[model samples]
Target chain A: MKPPKTDSSDFILSVQNLNAWYHTTQVLQEISFDIQRHKVTALIGPSGCGKSTLIRCFNRMNDFIATFKLAGQILLEGQDLYDPAIDPVEVRLRVGMVFQKQNPFPKSIYENVAYGPRISGIRRRHQLDAIVEESLKRAALWDEVKDKLKANAYTLSGGQQQRLCIARTLAVEPEVLLLDEPCSALDPIATAKIEELILKLKDDYTVVIVTHNMQQAARVSDFTAFFYLGELVEFWATDKIFTVPKDPQTEAYITGKFG
Target chain B: MNSTRQIKMRLIRQKWGDQVFQTIAVIGVLIALTTLAALLIDALSDGLPRIDWKFLTSFPSRKPAKAGIFSALVGSLYLITLTALIAVPVGVAAAIYLEEYTSQNSRINRIIEVNIANLAGVPSIIYGLLGLEVFVRAMRLERSLLAGALTLALLILPIIIISAREAIRTVPNSIREAAYALGATRWQTIQDHVLPMAFPGILTGIILSVSRAIGETAPLIAIGALTYVAFLPDGLRSPFTALPIQIYNWVSRPQKGFHTNAAAGIVILLALTLLLNALAIFLRNHYQKKHS
Candidate 1:
C-alpha cells in the first residue's frame, strides 16, 4: 500500500466534494471540510438534516445499508477511505466511533473494554487488564467499574453504560474518536461528565462530535460545522459560530427561532 | 353542549370496543389451552396404567402383552442426537448468512427467506419424499438411521432457520454497531456479539421444532424407516425404528391389548418431549441469566 501524500500537516481528515445517497435520494450534497488534529469539531444540524449520516461516512458505517451510495473522497491522514485497496475495517480501526445510544455488548464490563484489543490480537491476561484499566480511567469510569469489571455491562446505569462504551472505544487507541450525539441520551450530570471526558480526550485524539444541543456545541467544540438541508451552512471557530454566525439560518437555529 | 354529548358518546363506544377486544383475546388463549388439557387428560387416563418397567424395557413382540418400546426409545434418542448435530449448525449458519451477511434488498436473499417461511408451512410428508428421492435413492443411504435423521433434519430445518433469523433479528442494530465500530469484520461482529445475544430465542425454536420432529410418524414412514425393529440400530447405516412408528404399528393391531400398549408408548413419548423441552429451557435460561 502506498502512503497517502499530505498537503496540510495540521489536518487529520479532509472531505472533498463528498455526496451521499440512500439509493436514488441524495442526503449529503457536495460537502467538503478539513478537521484539524487534536481538536474537537462539532457537527450540529436539525433532525433528518444528515448529522448522523455525515459522521457515519467517516468510518464507512453506512456501507451496511445496501441502498447507501456515496461519491467523493474522504481522506484519513491523506489516504482515500473509499479506495478499494483500503479496507473499511482498517479505516474503522483508525477512526473509532461511539454511537448516540449506549450499546455495550452483553459481555462483562472487562470483556467489553478488551474486545477491540482481543480482536487486534492482544491475548495476554496482564496486557488486556492493563489496557482495560487504562482505557476506563481515560473515560473517567474506572472508579465506578474497577471493582466489578466482571459484572455485566447492562448492570451499569445509563450514564455509566455510555461511559463504558466510551472506554470500550478508547481501548482500541484510535487516532480519531467520533461521537454521534453522545450526550443526547444522557442526563445533565452524565452529560457534564461526558463533555468533560470529551475535552480531556482531545489532548491525545482528534475528536468529532455531533450534538443537537447548541449549548453543548458551544461548550465543548473548538470548531463548529453547521449543516442545514443537507448542506454545510457555516463552519468557523466555535466562539465565532455561536456569537456571530455568517449565515442567517445558523443564526435562526442557535437563537431557537426554528430548528 | 350538544357536541360535547356526541364526543362523550364516541368515547364510551371506544371503551366498549376495547373491552370486547380484550375478552376475545383472553378467550382465544383459553380455548387453545383447554383443548390441549383435554387431550393430555385422556392420554394420561389411558396410558398411565401400563407404564410399568416391564412395558418400557421389553422389545416389540408378536404378543401384545410382551411387547415393549425399548428398541424404539433407543432408536429415537439416537436419531434426535444425530438430527441435532446436522440441523442446528446448518440452520443457525443459514440464519446468520441471511440476517447478518446479506441484506434483504437482494432478490436471492429475499427469495430464500420467503422459501424458508413457506417450507415451515409445508407438510412433513413432503420433506420425507424429498429425503427419499435425494438421500435414499440418489445418495444410496438406504433405509439407515442416518437417512432417517437427514430426513427429519430437513423437515425441521426451516423451522429452526426461521426462528433463528427472528432471534438474530431481535439483536438490536446498536450492538452490531458497537462491534463494527471496534473494527470488527462482519464475521467477528456476528460471532462475538450477535449470535450470543440471539441464542435464547434460537434455543426456544429448537425446543419447539425438535418436539415436532419427535412426534412425526408419517415422514419417517414415507422415508421407509422400519415400523418394528426388535434390536437397537448397530450404527448410522443400520435400519432404525422410532417411537412414533412403533406406536403407529401397535395402534394399527386389532388386539385391544396392543392399543393399550400404544397408549403406554404415547406416555413415554410425552415424557421424552417434556424432558427435551425442560433441558432446552434450562440451557436457555442459564445462558440468559449469565449474560444479563
Candidate 2:
C-alpha cells in the first residue's frame, strides 16, 4: 500500500491505494479519493464499471460476501475503518445506506422507522415516537404518512416505500449516507422527489451516491468521480467535469458517444 | 401447402400425447383416492357399531367385547407431548444454527446438510433400536413412557430439522441485511425478525412431525413398550402402550370381537392424524393471508 495520505478534518472519508477482489477476480485497483464533509459526491459509470463496489466499501457492506477480499486503507473521520479493534457493526450504524430497491419490512410504517432506534436500546415509547416523526419529516414523507403510521409498510406506494426506507435509515442518526442507485426503479416524478431530498440531506450528512444518470450527477453532486474498468478515470467539481473534463474518456462517456 | 399440412399433423400428434398423459394422471389419482376410501369404509362398517361412550371409557379386559383404548389413548397423548417438548426446541435450534450461524459453503456445514437429508430417509426402526440402547438400557429408564417418548423424538428429529430449515430459509436475505444494517447482533436479528417471520412454517413442521411420531409403533415396540397396559401412564417413568401397539395386538388375535376393536382403534387414529393435519393447513393459510 502507498504511504497514508494526510486526511484533513474537512474530509469525512478517505480511501488510499485501495484494491478489492471477489475471490480471484479483481474488481477495483489502486483507487484513491477523499469525500468532503457535508457534500454530495456522485460516483458515475456504466454498468459493470465497479462504481457500486466502490460505494459499498464505504460502510463495509461487502463484508457479507464470503469471497470478497480487500487490501487498502478506508478512513472514516481520519480513523481506519478496517482496524481490528473497530466493529463493522459500529461502522454501519455510523454510516447508513439505502438500496436500489425499496425494502421496507413487513411491519407497520411506524415500526419500520422505529426499528433502528429500538435496536440501539431506545425503548421508551415517546422517545421512539419523536424519532419516527422527525425522521419521516426529514425524509419529506410525513405529510402523506403521518396519519397512517400504524398501517403496514407494504400498503405504501413504490415511491413512498423508498422514502420510508430513507426514514428508517435516518432514525439511527448516522453522520454519512450511502445510496446505491437509489432511484433506478422509480418513475421520473419519484426520481425528482428523491433528488430534491438528497440535495436537502447534504446540509447535515455527507452523501456518497452511485448513479448512472449523468444529468443526475450534474444536478445534485458537488463533485463527480468517473470510474471506468475498475479505475478512477477522473474526479473534479461537477461543473468542471461536465464542461471541461481533462480525460478524453470522461468526455466521451458524458457525451453519450460510447459507454 | 405441404409444410402447413405437416405442421397440422404435428399439432394433432402433440394433442394426442397430452390427452394420453392426462388420462394416466387421472387414473393415478383415482387409484390412490379409491384405496384410501375403501379402507375407511371397511373400518367404519365394522367398527362404527362398537364405538360408543362405554367403549371409549372402558379399560382393556380379557374378553374382547369389554376391551377399550383408554390406556393406549392416554399413553399416546402423554408420549407425544413429551416428545414434542424434547424435540421442538432442539430441532429448531439445530436448524437455525445450520442455516444462519454457519456459512453455506463451509465443508463441515455441507457434510452436515447431506447427513441430515439422509437421516430423514432412514427407517424408523433404526431409531427404535437406538432408543432401546441409549434411553432404555444405558440411561436406566427401562421400557417406560420416557424411553418411548425419547425414541419417538429421535425418529422425528430429522424431519423437524429439515422442515424448520426450509421454513427459516424462506425468510429472504434482504430482511436479514436490513436488520444487520441497524447494528443488530446475529442472535438479535434471528430472534426479533427471523424467528417471528418463520413461526408459522416452523409450527406446521412441528405438528406434522408430531403426528408422525404419534403413529410410530416399531420404535416403541423395539424399546419394549407394553401391549397390555391396563392403567393410564402415571408419570414419565410408568410403562405405557400406544394406539398402534394395541391395534397390532388386537389384529393378531383370532377372535372376531378383537378384530372389531382393532378397527375402531384404527378409526380413532385416523381421525387424530386428520385433525392435526387440518390444523397445520389452517395455520399456514391464516399466516399467508395476514402477510400477503
Candidate 3:
C-alpha cells in the first residue's frame, strides 16, 4: 500500500512534552511526537537514547517499575492514558507490544496465539481455533505450522518464534502494534520475512517500531524520529531524514560519522 | 632454561594438590556412609521380624509381643495433615507476594527478604519453643495434635517460603513482560505463567520440609506430648502421642523387649517418610517433563 499523505488529522497517537524518570535519574526529556493512523513510524537511535523508553510509555509498560515516574500526557486517539480512571491493562490490550527477544510462552503453539483472546474472556474452543488460524495466517506462519498446532512453541526456529510472537500480538486485534527491535535476535532470512509481515500490517494497524538498524527504518517506515540522550533530535518524512536531515546530529548519525 | 624448570615444578605441585583435595573429599563421603550403613543394618536386624499386621494393629501394652504403634501412627498422620494445610498455603502466598509483587530494591522489601533468610537458619527447636508459647499457651491449644502440627508448621514455614521464592525467580522476566503486554493482570501472570514453571521446584521444597518435620523429636517433647497415649486422638483438641515419643519411651525402659519394639517403630517411621518422599519426587519429575 502507498504511504498515506502527511495529515495531522490522521494522527492516532500524540505525545506532548512527555518527561520520564527512573528513580532520581531522568530518561526521556520533554519528548513530543505524533503517530499517524495506518502508518509505520520508526524510532531510530543509539543504545540508551530513550527510544525503547519512549515507545514503552505508549502502552504504560513502565508502570510496572516502582521507581519509574513520568509527567505529561500520552494521548491515544485523543484519550489521556495517564488519567487515573484509565486502567493500564485496558491500554495494553488496545495497544499490543512485541519484545526484542522471541518469548513464546511454554505452551503449545496454538495456545500461545490464543493467549490474548483467552485472557480477554473468550472461552469457546471453536472460536479460539478460528482466531488462532487467522492470526497465524496474517503473520505468514500458517502453512508451515497448520499441522502441528499442538506442538510446543520453542520447537520452532528463532525466525518462526519471532513471527509467532507477532501472531500472538495480532490475535487480540489491537488498534496499534509496538515493536521494540523485534528482529534484532533473528537471522537475515527471518528478518526479511518479518519486514514483509510488518509492511502488510501497516494497512490495518498503526505501527511504532524502535530499531537500531538505519537501513531497516528506511526500508519499512514512512516517518522516522531520531533521538539522542533522552531528547528528540529530529522527526520528519523518512526520505528527508535520509537525504537532508534538518539537525546536524541526525545528519552525522545517518552518514555514520558517530553514533 | 631455569624459568622453564620452575614452571614445570609449579605445574607438578598444582597437580599434586588437586589429588590431595580429591582424596580428602572421598574420605569424607566414606566416613559418612559407614556410619549410616551401621545404623541401617542394626535397625533392620532388630525390626524386620516385628513388622507384621498384628504388630501394626494392637495398642501399647505391658506384654512385649502384644504391644503395637496404632495410636502413634494415627497421631502422626493427623499432625502432618494439619501442618501441611497450615504451612503450604501461607508460605507459598508470602513467597508469591515477595517475588512477583514487591520491588527488590525497596527498603522494606529488602528487610523482609533478609529476615526470611535468617528465619530459615534459626534452629527448629527455637520454633518449637515459640510454638509452645504462642499456640499451646497463648492460643490455648494445649498439648493436643493441633498444637504439635502448628509448631511443626512454623518450623518448616521458612523453608517453604525460601524454596517457592527460588522457584518463582527461575522464571524469566521476558515471560512476565509478554503476559503483561497481553493485558494480563499481575495475579493472572503469576498464576498462569510463573506458578506453572515453578511448581516442580516448590513441590521439592514442600517434600523436604515435611520430611524434616516428621523426623523432628525435640520440639514435640518440649511441647509436652505424651509417650503412652493408649487411644487415637478423638478430635483437634484431644491429647496425642507421636512415633518419636513412643520410641523414646520404649528405649528408655529397663525391659529388653521395649528396645526391640522401639527399633520396630523406627522402621515404620522410616518407611512412611520414604513413601512420602517418593510420591513427591514422582510429581516433581512429571511436571518438569511436561513443561520442559
Give model 3's DockQ, 2 decimals: 0.81
**Superior by lDDT: candidate 2 or candidate 3:** 3
Q: Which sequence of candidate numbers ranks them by DockQ, best first?
A: 1, 3, 2
TM-score of chain A of each: 0.96, 0.96, 0.97
Q: Would you give the TM-score of chain B in model 3?
A: 0.94
**Candidate 2: segments with Cα more than 4 A from true spot:** A1-9, B1-4
Instruction: Give the clash count for model 3.
Output: 0
**Per-residue alpha-carbon lDDT of candidate 3 for residues B171-260, written as tens digits (9 for 90 to 100):** 999999999999999989998999999999999999888987888888898888998888999999999988888888889998989889
- lDDT by residue for model 2 over B1-292, one digit each (tens)? 5699899999999999999999999999999999999999999988888898877777888899999999988888999999999999999999999999888899999899999989999999999999999999999999999999888888889999999999999998888878877777788889988888898999999999999999998998899999998899998899999999999999999999999999999998988899999999999888866664
Looking at model 3, the pairs that clash are none
Question: If scored against the real structure, what TM-score would every candidate get?
Answer: 0.94, 0.96, 0.96
Q: How many pairs of residues collide in each model?
A: 0, 0, 0
What TM value does chain B of candidate 2 have? 0.97
Per-residue lDDT tens digits of candidate 2, residues A1-259?
A: 2211334448889988889999899999999988888989999988988999998888888988889999999999889988899998899899999988888888999999999999899999999999999999999999999999999999998889999999999999999999889899899999999999999999999999999899999999988899999988898878988999889999999999887
Which lDDT values do the candidates have, in the order given?
A: 0.91, 0.90, 0.91
